[model samples]
Target: MADIQRLSLNQATVQNWSVKEAVDGCVRHGIPSIALWRHKIHEAGLQQSAQHVRDAGLHVSSVCRGGMFVAPSAAERKERIMDNFRAVEEAKELNADSLVMVVGASTEVPIADARQMVADGLAELVPYAREQGVKIGLEPLHPMYAGDRSVLNTIDQSLAMAAPYAADEVGLILDVFHIWWDPTVFEQIQRAAGRIFGFHACDWLVPLPDTLLGRGVMGDGVIDNHALRLAVDAAGYNGPIEVEIFNQALWDTPGDDVLNKVVERFTALV
Candidate 1:
């Protein structure tokens, strides 16, 4: 059985629940940790969200998202960077383990230029995050999202992007949904070692219902979540194993029921 103590309820899995509700769900379901999204945090009021998690004694595994560096103009890029500065502040306020960064994709610029922009953005943001005592988790989206969501589309790419920074300052957030198909994923996971800040689990549906919102719960699809979990464990990431599904069907279900399913599938498959 997977360790129940290590399961973290990423708020995206229960999209309908408010921050306080998510925290309460964690308390009721015995989930020890949570990964929060910024919109939900803002909706619940940042201080209130922090206080709720604090009072419930739940660990904040990570704060969802603080990147999107690609832009057509310098002013727009600067705006995004400033927003990341605010994200760092938010992460510090919640005492989160890291600030998850879904680095932006190429806009009108060349793909190579977009990548350089991501590198430069990280160069600036990492120091600020470090100063705030927060870690930056560079999350590589699936390659399909490379044109719209993120330029960093593989574990190797994310690791390369993180190479210039100390492991604690910047690291990789490895998601099974995004990276399970890679031929060298296991080798990359081993290479990540001390540089993996978070581990996310979700299955990839065979038919792929929706590119962005079609992720399956741990066992509902083709990925060998257990093997991946073992690989991450072998890679020395002994922290929370977050369930971060993005399926509309799951979101439409009652939040408690979804949590129940998550616990069941995670225990059996992950």
Candidate 2:
């Protein structure tokens, strides 16, 4: 049987829900885990937010990011590195499994150059992350998002970059929504193998909106969620199936309604 207990509540799902409210909702629904974002922690106060999640008896699968490793100047790159230090501290406080890394967008330099910068940043940050007891999960954004979001746009490419990092302590964050459209999903999954960390999920619409928002519910989209989950599980990642939808319309609705649908959809399909 699929472990429904592995389902996680990613904070972006409830843009309207407060930290306490979201955690409480998870507690109510018995959603075993969650993935948190830095902005949300700031809003609730980190201590309060961490405590809320801990109090609800929920496992924090990951802290949803710290990397933007590409910048124009040395100063800017260093600033990003320093920022990740703070993210590491936050992750340590919550005892989260990993710190998700979105290896930045392309700059005036070049996507290839930006990618090198990401590699350089990880070379330094990975050791720091290990020392701080925080694993970094490098997530490859979709190709469409490569220009403004991430240069690392495929699982195979992500793993190739991640290979130099610590295998046990530094890894990849596999979100099916971003990479499902790729031609080599399964091959990458097989390549990723043990390096796979958190397996995030969300349905992708055919006519995706203008890079802003437009996500379909689990079954509403064209992605085969079962196949996605099967690949992750087959790769030996028996962790939370963290849901990370970025739908503007869904965010506008009440969290209860949103979560009710999410839990139902994930249960029935993903």
Candidate 3:
């Protein structure tokens, strides 16, 4: 059986839940950790949100995002970076393990240019993250999100981008839903080794009707969660396993019921 303590609920899994409710849900369900999102954190008030998580005796696995360097101009890029700095600060205040970065989507600029922007932006933030004693998790979102969500779309690319910094300063977010289709996933997991910041669990459906909201619960779709779990474990990642599905159906369901199903699936399939 998967150790319940190692399993974490990403707030997006139950999108409708208030921050307080999510934290309390975790506490009630014996979930010892969570990966939080920015909107929900702001909605609950930062200090209060932090206190609530602390009061619940929950560990924050990571802060949901701190990237999006692909902008139309220098000024826009600067604004994005500034916003990311605040995200880093929030992560630190929450005592999160890492500040997750979604990087950026491809804009009018060439894809190469957008990628360089990501690298350049990180060059600036990595120092600050390290200074604040927080790791920057470079999450390579799926290729499908390349146009509007993320330009970094593979583990190898994410690792290469993070190569300039030490593992403690820059790491990778390995979401099974995103990278499961990559042919070299297993090899890259081994390559990631100590640099794996967090491992996210979700399933990708075939003929995905709604790309953004089509994520299936663990074992309900095609992913072999057990195999992927073993791979991450063998790669020496002993951190929280975060469930980060973005399904409208799941979100519409009652929060407690969604969490219970998540725990059940995690126990049986992950």
Show the lowest summed lDDT stretch of 10 residues, model 3.
103-112
Clashing pairs in 3: none
What TM-score should be assigned to candidate 2? 0.97
Q: Residue pairs in steric clash, candidate 2?
A: none
How high a TM-score does candidate 3 get? 0.98
- Highest lDDT against the true fold, candidate: 1
Per residue, candidate 1 scores C-alpha lDDT tens digits across 1-270 of: 588899999999999999999999999999999999999999999999999999999999999999999998999999999999999999999999999999897659778999999999998898889899999999999999989889999888888999999988899999999999999999999999999999998899989999999999987889999999999999999999999999999999999999999998888888
Report the error of model 2 at residue 118, Å.
Answer: 0.1
The C-alpha stretches of model 3 lying farther than 4 A from their native spots are none
Better of 1 and 2 by TM-score: 1
lDDT of each: 0.94, 0.86, 0.92
lDDT value for candidate 3? 0.92
In terms of TM-score, how similar is model 1 to the real structure?
0.99
Query: Comparing candidate 2 with candidate 3, which one achieves the higher lDDT?
Result: 3
User: How do all the candidates rank in terms of TM-score, highest first?
Assistant: 1, 3, 2
